[model samples]
Target: MNPSKTGLSFLWLSAVAFIADLATKYLVVTRFALYESIDILPFFNLTYVRNPGAAFSFLANHSGWQKIFFIVLAILISAMLVYFLFKNNAAQKLQNAAYALIIGGALANAADRAYHGFVVDFLDFYWQDWHYPVFNVADIAICVGAGLLALDAIKNGDKKKSEKKA
Candidate 1:
């Protein structure tokens, strides 16, 4: 199959990811109480937490301006991602996937912020006395997408160098 054709498929992946993120957030909100924790394993738990700011609760302590800031920022970023996805060549499958994932995740979180003034988080991982920040499906998508983009950059760079030597 042509790699360039993969870009269109990535758009579908974005839709699926957005829907899944919304579905999971709905379940968590309806079934769990705020700050409630349910142990699923020795190292993981479902913990309900609201983040009004960016990752790691950045700017969460501010006087509520961050909510508006993040909502607008997410919208802008998502638009940019969509533009990039369309502009990207078909052979850049990984890059297209990266754009799709980031766009989907951004929209999901932005929806939450618009409706609830914060993002709903539930998945939690911890060990012994240390605990990682709670997150949700949207966060996962964004992180994975960003990683893929980085990998694509490195791979493309290598390809260019190889071509130059030939």
Candidate 2:
């Protein structure tokens, strides 16, 4: 419940996640060719792809304006996540993890936007001929963090109900 502890935990998680994301992106950029696919498993593969747009290549076609808009959005979201970390009880691990995950992913993608004007995606999943959209570490962090946050909410809600009945 201590503010310092929460802030420290958040910083630790964010730093680790950010570093990992950056390292992975660097590896992918240096080692893989654009649109090249490396099969990692029967149902998964690492396929290098650059997405100038948002998730699932949304607005991938519009080149000029959408880039700036998405960059601004990512920055705003990162700022909001930081604010949430400061305002909420960071002592709660799940809440802290959620904030850290968001910050890390936002930072990773923002870095990509600044450097390359696009985000590097590689991870892919498929069943036979059906393939899912390729994604990267940042997207993974966002999804995992969101799931954790959702679970935390349900847990806290149950706690509140139990207290009310007692």
Candidate 3:
């Protein structure tokens, strides 16, 4: 099927997200020393660091095996997102965009995994002595995409309920 006729066209967004992720990571990796941090705002910082595991560095302290597992998982999820977009109508704009962002983020992280053996995280947020995990552009895209998807799901559920009652 022609990509322009389907949600596949949203891959442009994927390309943008992927490039942004890579560029930011490159800058952080090249410009900063490991664990180096620079404050951007009272509650935010640009701290360069490496993550060996998924979100919040889950299983980061594990042996070398988590790298392969995460890389494979990212590939599988990216494929699944593409499949979901390919199989559906372009009218599902919310889902399409969501899938595209996830695809871009997953692939970008996978690339980082294969190249750096870790995901580069730099956007840091904190309040007082407490700090949130450092993350990057891909993480932001993935999270925003996920939130959009959830919002869409909730909206459709409401629509379905209203239709059922009519």
Candidate 4:
């Protein structure tokens, strides 16, 4: 299959995710001082912060090595996701969208790591004093993509079970 017309058709979704992430990060970085926060609601805030490590600040306490590690991992994962997209059938809309989102989110974060050494995060949600991790558009895309994949798995599992029972 010609990837450009086949699975690669989903690249548009990837581009949307990538562009959105960068744009939001750019706005946050330009408008907010580091660690500056503005409460938007009882459970939400816009808090500018930087994450040098992976999800939930994993390995964030290290000196500086985590930046390189995350960047490299993002690149590797993005490449792998592209490969998966290329191999996937165009009719597999759910999987294609999931892969595209993961690719875009990964590449966006990698670009941030390359240019800024850390991912700019601004969206914050909390309940009282306990706050969830601050994250940005790219993180949202990655998480949504993962959730979609899990939902696809559940849907397919049911189909397989029905086919077996028949």
What lDDT score is found at residue 83 in candidate 2? 74
lDDT, model 4: 0.90
Model 4 TM-score is 0.94
Report every candidate's CA lDDT.
0.89, 0.85, 0.92, 0.90
- Candidates' TM-scores? 0.93, 0.92, 0.96, 0.94
Tens digit of lDDT per residue, candidate 3, span 1-166? Answer: 8777788989999999999999999999999999999988999999999999989999899997999999999899999889888887888888899999988998999899999999999999999999999899999989988997998899889999999999
What's the CA RMSD for each of the models?
Answer: 2.5, 1.8, 1.0, 1.3
Clashing pairs in 2: none
Highest lDDT: which candidate?
A: 3
Task: Order the candidates by TM-score, highest first.
Answer: 3, 4, 1, 2
Q: After TM-score superposition, what is the CA distance of residue 159 in candidate 2 from its true location, in Å?
A: 1.6
Q: RMSD of candidate 4 to the true fold?
A: 1.3
Q: Which ranges of candidate 2 are over 4 A from the true structure? A: 1-3
- How far residue 19's Cα lies from its native spot in candidate 3, in Å, is 0.6
**For model 3, the run of ten residues with the poorest summed lDDT:** 1-10
Look at candidate 2 and tell me the lDDT of residue 52: 88
Q: Model 4 clash pairs?
A: none
